[model samples]
Target: MNILFIEDDMIESMKFQRTLSKIASRHTIIEAKNGEQAIDALKNSESLPDIILLDLNMPRMSGIEFLQILKADEQYKYIPTIILTTSENRADLLECYRIGIAGYVIKPLKYEDYEQKLTAVLAYWQTNELVKA
Candidate 1:
């Protein structure tokens, strides 16, 4: 599966890549540092990603802002976006669901925990049938 990973922190981005490398090699990851970059990727790519793993906090545009634009557009609304953020705020959680996210995963503190969560998330998405244009 092709994944669009949207995150601004370089260390966190590297950690996610490392986790993916350890858990699965069949999947492909496309990195975007912020919502603006993510939007550009969506607009310019020939093929859209199978899923989007987004971080709530980012520069240029917040994840909610990005979701608003994405969900509003007929061309992009079908893509399943999963929030992979550290925020545990109820308001944020409710907002993401309200905006129509496929999943919401709060990043755990430990690397092992993070890896486990990512592994399950990836496995589920990989095996599950998804919407295709």
Candidate 2:
């Protein structure tokens, strides 16, 4: 699976990368520090990502803003995006769902728990069929 992981935190991003390596070694993860960078990555890539693992909070374009842009674009709207965020706020969750996120995952504090959740998420998406552009 080709995954575009949008996150700003270096430590958290590194941790997620490690966990992803363990759970889905064959999958390729393309990292983007913010929403703008993500858009640039998408534009430069020959093929679109199979899914996007987005972080709700970031420096420049917040995940919500990014979602609005992505969902509005007919060419990219079909790509499934899942939120991998630390925010547990109800408003964030509701808003992400409203914007058409495939799933909203709260990052677990414990490393083991985080790994487990990430593993399950990757496994589910791996088997699921994605919409073709």
Per-prediction tally of clashes: 0, 0
Collision pairs in model 2: none
Predicted structure 2: clash tally:
0
Cα-based TM-score, every candidate = 0.96, 0.95
- For candidate 2, the TM-score is 0.95
The Cα RMSD in angstroms, rounded to one decimal, for candidate 2 relative to the true structure is 1.5
For each candidate, what is the lDDT? 0.91, 0.91
| Candidate 2 wrongly placed segments (more than 4 Å) | 131-133
Lowest lDDT 10-mer window, candidate 1?
Answer: 124-133
- Whole-model alpha-carbon lDDT for candidate 1: 0.91
Write candidate 2's Cα lDDT for 1-133 as tens digits.
8999999999899898789778635887899999999999999999899999999999899999999999999989989999999999999999999999999999989999999998998888888866332
